[model samples]
Target: MKRIAILNCLKANDVCAGAACLKAFNSRSRHFEQYGAEPIELVAMGRCNGCEVGIDEGFQEKLDRIIEEGAEVCHLGVCTIKSETRQECKTITEAANYLETHGVQIVRGTH
Candidate 1:
């Protein structure tokens, strides 16, 4: 199984139902559809350290740790990218940059 990790939005967690993200990943819909046969093993699911105010302490460290644990791919949950709020966009960008800098392949979108 290919190890993967999800980076979600902390703020969206309060309001979003997460059904779309869950369905897409579980059913291999949207971006997930490209995986032909390899089964995805979700190794970690973490939220953006905090809201737009600022990234939480040790956010980068935590993300790097996920990769160290064998997460070859990191995905941004829908809440991190598709949300209408600008704060969400910032968080997404930040998470993407961090993951990329740490050499983790990023796959945008979950469900």
Candidate 2:
């Protein structure tokens, strides 16, 4: 089975339950359409380290856990890309780069 992880926006964590992203993945629709009939597993659901601290502080620990769980691909949730400022976008890019360096394929959107 294909192992997948989802990285969401930290700012939305309090208000969002991630139901939309999960629904899209489970139904193989929207951003998850490419999976089609393949057997896929949702291995991890994580968030950015927060705007103030960025991903530099403790993000690596979270990434390590995701990797340990066998996440082959990671999808950046919609909330992550709906950046209100350039800094947010840059942070998302940095997160994606970090994931790539660790050998995980990055998918830009979740739902």
Candidate 3:
């Protein structure tokens, strides 16, 4: 059981970032919990305004708030990043790289 934080870039393309990200992260978290893995804390880290592709001030704000609420691992699974949007996907990869650099193990949702 690992303490994980799944991060959603939540960049804007069309869909609402907050609700969409929460939905994906929650679904993934449910799967992890079902498998008896340490469930992931869904952390939506990005600008709701869809300004930047990378985790920036908005990202820090969200991350800080979520951390204050006790969130840890980082998973990028927002539709913008994980499914359709290109920049968002890049953010996801960067997030994975950052998390690993920060000493967290980066793995897939199936893990």
Best by lDDT: 2
What is candidate 2's lDDT per residue for 25-103, written digit by digit as tens?
9999998999989999999998988878777757878888888898999999878765565244678788789888889
Worst 10 residues of 1 by lDDT: 79-88
Q: What's the lDDT for all of these models?
A: 0.75, 0.87, 0.49
What C-alpha RMSD separates each model from the true structure?
A: 2.6, 1.8, 4.9
Each candidate structure's TM-score, on Cα atoms with residue i matched to residue i, is 0.78, 0.90, 0.48
Find the candidate with the highest TM-score and give its number: 2
Q: Output the TM-score of candidate 3.
A: 0.48
lDDT of 1 by residue, 1-111 (tens): 878887888768778776676677788778777776889877877777676455566676778778787888888876675545534477668768777887788987777
Residue-level lDDT of model 3, residues 1-111, one tens digit each, is: 345565533444456435544564456543344434344444434443243536677665665554554445554443434454345455556556655665655544422
Cα displacement (Å) at residue 5, model 3: 2.0
Looking at model 2, residue 84 earns an lDDT score of 63
Q: Which wins on TM-score, candidate 1 or candidate 3?
A: 1
